[model samples]
Target: MSILVTGATGTVGSLVVQRLAQQGAEVKALVRTPAKAALPAGVTAVPGDLTDVASLRRALTSVRTLFLLNAVVPDELTQALVMLNLARDAGVQGIVYLSVIHADLYSNVPHFTGKHSVERMIERFELPATVLRPAYFMQNDLQARGAIEGHGVYPMPLGSAGVAMIDVRDIADIAASELLRRHWAADPLPRLTLDLAGPDALTAASVAALWSEALQREVRPAGDDLESFEQQWAHFAPGWMAYDMRLMMAAIQQHGMKPAEGSVQRLETLLGRPLRRYRDMVRESGQLKLG
Candidate 1:
């Protein structure tokens, strides 16, 4: 069974594509630009957009399984809904959806709500699926290296509550495994949801301390000045995306992306290893600039 990976050019999607290819799975990547997709040698790049029905229809040809990882955008839900309907029409046997942790709990956040809506569609349509709810990507902190290394500060609004940030590599591995499991099963498997989290529940202070130890200097939290976060993103991202991020941060402030009981044990058992740690991620990523 061939697998169709939506958002295959994105951060986690791209990683999943690589893992699937390494496992010798037949992989098809749905991307806007086939010419520029730069996929693995055996992976086929199918030119398509989530909003374009005709394009998606063509991409779904002969695809038995789907990996849906929609980006955060103004029309995210519309894109996901259209893709799900098309996947059903094409007789997609199974789906692996990448949704946010605490998606339902963070009700007011647009992106979180959008993902929850996708999950509902998967359930309502009775699609055989595995939903992966991952916390904040630890690699996203790499983007703040300049702030941490140069200015001695952790710029993200991690708040007093702690988040168990997961590694993208682990997520990709689990996604690939699930895709193959669904593809190989003779009988239709029941729906499952997994909360992907790291080994430690880290707060702003803890994150700052890690940076301090890494860089061999004093580092402080930027505090939860959400307006500044919004302002910073507004300059780079579209207005709606920026506002959506602010809402996410606000929700994080009130309720951390804490995983359910045995979440760590479950992930560790699946991988046969301990979940990746924030300190290890920082060290391995070469974030430390020796003074």
Candidate 2:
């Protein structure tokens, strides 16, 4: 089975490509630049831009399964729709969409709304798809490693409230399974929607404690004001991204990031093992920084 992975050079998409290739699958990485794809051996890097439907036609050629991960761009919805149309036309059998957790609940966020819009299109088109709503990535904390190591503080906007953040590794494994697993019966399995998270529901304070233990330093918990956070983030990122993230963080602050009961266990079942906790992520952060 020939599988094509979009956003192949990204955090989650790259891992999916590696997992599929390691499983002995015929993998095609649909990236904008094949020379810079940096994919594993045996994985074919096919140059293609999702924004250009014509380019997608060449990449989707003979691709039976597709792993779709739309970047957080202003034209995300348009790009996703174009890819969906091309995939449908190319006779791609299955699609595994990498979507944000709580996208349905927090549809007001622009990026989440964009993903939801594409999801609606996928359902409306009656495509064979599996939607993976993965929680906030543990890798996001790496951005604040400097603060943890130097300033000795955790500075996320999330307050004392707990969120069920997950590891990208788990997301990649589950996505690969959904994309490559074959059905036993003649009838194809129904389209599935999974809410994925880590083993523990962690708060900002708890995260600080983990960092302190891992780094053997006093990493204090520092609550962030949303307004300041947005202002600071906007300076570095796009205005819309800062605004969208601000709104999402506000929602999380108001309504805690706690997952539904049994959600963790269900995710573990799909992962085929226990999910990684914040401490585990902290322990691995040092290695991640070097990479």
Candidate 3:
């Protein structure tokens, strides 16, 4: 049976599709535009939108497993429900959902709330499903490239809060493996949710230090107050998104965002090796410039 990957053009979803295809699985990628989907050679591209049930149904025609990842948008819960209903109707056996860490704790963040809603829906459906609650993406560091290059600084409101940031590629690997594994591979197909994280926790300052060492240059950490940060980002992000970002940052600052012990072990067990570290991601992305 083929595996259908939603949001196939996104950071994690794209890697999931590519890895599944590389592993010789019959991969079907659901993309909003087939013209722009540069999927791997053997994967099939189907034009579909997660918000449109008809499009999702068309994409799930013969697929057995699905990697469901959606972008944050207005009415995300409604759209997710539409997609879930269609998947159920289409007889898809397994679903692997990408969720955020501490989704249960930070219900105020719209994106995390949307993911929690989807998790509940998946449970209600009682279909074979695996939910991966991963920490913040280390790839987010790439967005600071301009700042790193121009001013040698990394700025965020995370403060001294340390988080076990996971690389998107590691999450993709786990998702692909879960989707491809036989139903009876383990009794009852394991638990519903898995918390995937990197090997170590690091604060914003520690991250800046790692980049400084990697680049052989001073990398400062800076951020305005949360209110100011929200106001500044509101100019570029939607109002709701800006608010959610601020709330999420505040939660991270107060709660420290670190994963529980053995979270990384779980990821390592799934991948049969240690997960990639943030420093590795920086080097791989060529963002680490050595003096």
Candidate 4:
């Protein structure tokens, strides 16, 4: 069965493509630019856009499984609905959707709210699907790597709250498992929804301490104020995007992303191994250079 993976160039999607291809699965990657996709040798790169229904139809040909991953855009709901309808029309048998944790609880956050809408769409269609709602990405710290390395500070707006963040790689592993697991034509289809998180729930200060120990520098939490976070992103992001990010962060600061019971254990069972620790990710990435 050929699996069509959308958002194939993104962090999680790219890793999923690589994992599926390495496992000898026939993987088709949907990308805006096939020339720049740079997927593995055996993986097929199909040029398509979620907004372009015609293009998606062309890409979905002979595709049995679909990994639907959409970016967080203002029109995310529209794009996802268009893609979902197209995928169903194309006779795609199974789908694996990447979503955020607590999407229902944080409806005000545009990203979470958008994902919640898509989740409902999948359920309404009654598709043979597995929905993965992963907690915060550990790799998000890479955006603030410069601040941690140069200024020795963790400058996120996550206040004193703890988050059970998971690595994007683990999320990819789970997605691949769903797409690649063997199922006969007569076998019962599994409709699953899983919430994934890391083994440890770490706060901002705890993360800073990890960086400090890893880099041999006194890294500390820069501040917990939303205004400072807004200012930091505003310098590079559009005004509305900066505000959107601030809104999301403020919610996290106020109500931490604590995982439900058995979330980590379930993730580990899916991955067939222990979840990757934040400190281990930093060490293996070779980003912990001493200053």
Against the true structure, whose TM-score is highest? 1
Candidate 4 regions with alpha-carbon error over 4 angstroms: 182-188, 287-291
Backbone N/Cα/C clashes per model: 0, 0, 0, 0
Q: Residue by residue across 59-101, what tens digits does model 4's lDDT show?
A: 9899888899988777888988888888789888788888888
- Quote the lDDT for 143 in model 3: 83
TM-score of each: 0.97, 0.93, 0.93, 0.94
Evaluate residue 94 in candidate 4 and report its C-alpha lDDT on the 0 to 100 scale. 83
| Candidate numbers sorted by lDDT from highest down | 1, 4, 2, 3
Off by over 4 Å in 3: 182-191, 287-291
lDDT string for model 1 (1-291, tens) is 699999898889999999999989899999898998889989999988998999999999998999998888789999989988988999888889999899999999999999999899889978899999999999999999889988998999989788999999999988998999998788668999999989888889999998888888899999999999999989989888899999998988889888999999998888888878888888887856532
TM-score quality measure for candidate 2: 0.93
Stronger candidate by lDDT (3 vs 4):
4
lDDT of 1 at 248: 93
Better of 1 and 3 by TM-score: 1
Which candidate leads in lDDT?
A: 1
Q: lDDT of each structure? A: 0.90, 0.82, 0.81, 0.85
* Model 2 clashing residue pairs (backbone): none
